[model samples]
Target: METGPISAILDTTLAIIFTWVGYKTAAIVWKYTPYSYPNARINAMEAKLLSEQRFNELAESRTLQNFVVNLEDTDYRDYLTGISTYNVEEIERSLERALAGTYELMIKILPGRVSPFFRLMLEEWDVRNVTSVVKAKFRGEPASDYVMEIGPMLPKVKAMAEAKSPEEMLVILEGTPYEGPYQRLLLGEISIQEFETELYRMHYGKLLSYALSKKNDERVILEEFVRLRIDRTNILTVLRAKAAGMDSEKIKSLVIPGGSVKLDPLIHVEDLSMALAELDSTRYGKVIRDVREEVEKDLSVLERALDKYILERMGELTRFYPLSVATPLGYILKREREIRKLRAIAKLIEDGVEPERIKELVGDVA
Candidate 1:
């Protein structure tokens, strides 16, 4: 055989093997990539069931008995029916259980790959649970009651609840994404509020990384939504800090990165007007500007505006991307908000608060 021909044959054989391996690997990935079509119909149906009218009616019911009776006919009946008393504590417990149930349902329906996103969403609950545990441990109070049984973080949450000290709680978070923040908390390097912010930062960072790893239109929408959420969070934090008379340096330290709003202008903001001016050019500028007057009256008003803006934006994304994960995500957020509103109404009614006042607090679901 000629030497040149033999070399060429060897090269050709190697190329064919490598090409076949690449093709097979890609085929495997494609087979398990989790297309959004599997849950499209389910997402649409769920969104329809979360109508504003349903929430409005729940909010309108004057008495606990009336609220329970009306709720029995809704999807939340399973969670609410178990409550035999109208006590605030019982109502809060029922609301927590209902939220846990919602997460369980979401995990069951979402594809395995898609489930991670929902799990990341559930990290909020985990952070709250951990915060409650840390506070309880600080105050020497029992915390097992506040631990939420949702997502993979539940084990860590349980461990933290049983922890005797902040250091012990930090140990419970070891090997998890939250370990770094918890360690900082143990070292007294960050306040509890700052630690909570760090947990959120970690969650958003993980979600952003996952979204970037998937190069698809659906992931693009998800990534954008995540960015908007980060922006909303940062804005709310700044507003709250300002309301509490915090300085600019402290406020800047609390602002999480990876949001759509640039950091340069925000870092120099010393007051509400300055913050509004800095955010005026961003996507949320118009909404914040519109509510500036109300925000001055009460900083909490700005928080509501931020929530409504994010919810409305999510709703828009769901409408535009009905066949993607956006719809399911939108439904999840809307359902969570509805649950919160319902819980608030139940609490107010249990406290004998005025009906008009309760309605004002519930706000417009639409």
Candidate 2:
């Protein structure tokens, strides 16, 4: 295909036009999307609320009963009403609708430049759906009741229609991507603990590979962030298992392959005290600082501590990288925070918790 003079000129002109359009589109996005200032303010607020002392206190307490510590706003009332009204069917419908709208938005904004960011955002949603399905399968939940139908994967409601046992689940999921993990667990070749550990590793490992495949600069940072989050999760998981009387062999089998957890230190930790000491020796030492007291007294404290830790960490990252993938990620975190706040307020209002107690729970409620 030899290009004539006119054809060459037209091709060159179209190329220039497309390049300019792409540049202008990206410039507009860059200008409007830098919510770093607001993010920073929120991060500061989080730091104040989740100070080291506060974190230690949360870790020491079993109940997040303080979730609504401070309350004066009717906003919480509406939020609670909304949450209370959402039945399982309603939540599934809403999640599907939200995912469809988000995917449409992603397709529109994802020029060559933003494809990586779009995918990074989608990864979180993917994990949510996968985790939901896997758990649903374990509990013999119905597909419509379990799977959120908004992703690249084909809908498999029929496949899981009569799955009431793990063995039944394996037969149903035989050819699906989830089959391998489900089978590994169902066959007794692998424990549920190992299945959970490996499944998450596979998800994040795929995510990291996807990020690197994009060959983008900011994505490198996002990948590191993903890795760090996974490490924290694994650490929390190990801590909980130790509390549950899991042998070191089981703990080792369940630890995700990658990240800062060295096999030797992990193997040496026999009890909660030893586990905390070993954890203190790792890079996450700062993350689990002074958490032993809580681990010693109540295991539920670890859940609160982990939640507070991730919230604080994500809040900080949202501030640091406002316009990039972190902004949307932060928004997701904010939405979660809002949901929890709603739940807390609703529980408080329903239980008629004293205003003073509510104040202590949510902390200077608005």
Candidate 3:
């Protein structure tokens, strides 16, 4: 039977639609299937994450010795058991080694195809390593005896550790995307805070760009996660700048380009208190608002809020794609919170800050 032109067009359109649906379904299945075994291990790891109660118990310890004894009761035991003293550096290196172990495990278990995304995620840690070395160099301190020593960024980290000063560090970073910001720092055109802000922009920009390039479940989750982080960074940056009495224009200048919020309203205000007030309507405002009084008392509270916010967002995304990259990534992010919060507790102990105060502040994460 001869069909009319409209009927033939409808048939072709239906065929195309069905083909796209089938292709997408297959792609999703393919993307997630390889992660099944990796995620089972991830699930086991996630199940072992420190409960709020445990963090509290550790925080309640009366001395650094007590905290170490308490820590020996958890998964951190294997990583920290050798530590006899409570030095902050000793604690940080042990915690970071545990983290480095996780990163290595993930890189090994992850399907080869998924390496780039995971590697990009590790860039955040690399940024921290570089900053740590830079600050140590400025203080005339020796390079950190401990570096993560993993991932493709290892060479860069090694080079940074070898540099004797910030200028030397800038020379190592030259020709990389991060060079301009560090150079500006060396030339006194930008503060370390501003330089760190640029590192974050470059990191998220790289992750978001790659996430946008892929067409899959992982991309959807990653893209959303990256943009959420960008928003978090912008929010905190604006708030801190305003509090510092930075010029309104200069405050805006530090705003990263690809965030999810319309922060212009929050960033444009000259008054710190007013700028924070303007934050009431943004997506991440609740974190700051929930701890408003504390944030007012100590600006560091906002930093902790944002870190928890970022980790919470990762957990939420992991639930959305139960069998994908988000699962392992979630474990890594949560473990990081555990490590960072632990570091804070150790630092407090080293400073002779009371355990009750530590429990009050550093016990758990959002």
List, residue by residue over 1-366, the lDDT tens digit for candidate 2: 676988989999999999999999997676445444544544453343333243233233233233322221322322223333433343334434444454445445534454455554454444456556666666666544655555554344434544565567567566755678767766678865566666677767766666656544356545655666667677776777777888887777777755646656755577777877887777666656756675678755555565566556656765665555554445444444444444444455455665456546765221
Best by lDDT: 3
**TM-score, per-candidate, Cα-based:** 0.81, 0.62, 0.80
- After best superposition, candidate 2 residue 141: deviation in angstroms? 6.7
Candidate 1, lDDT over the whole model:
0.74
Model 2 misplaced regions, further than 4 Å: 1-154, 157-159, 163-175, 214-216, 290-292, 299-323, 347-356, 364-366
Which structure is stronger by lDDT: 1 or 3? 3
What TM-score would you give candidate 3 relative to the actual structure?
0.80
Per-structure clash totals for the candidates: 0, 12, 0
Stronger candidate by TM-score (2 vs 3): 3
**Model 2 Cα RMSD, 1 decimal:** 9.4
Quality of model 2 by C-alpha lDDT: 0.56
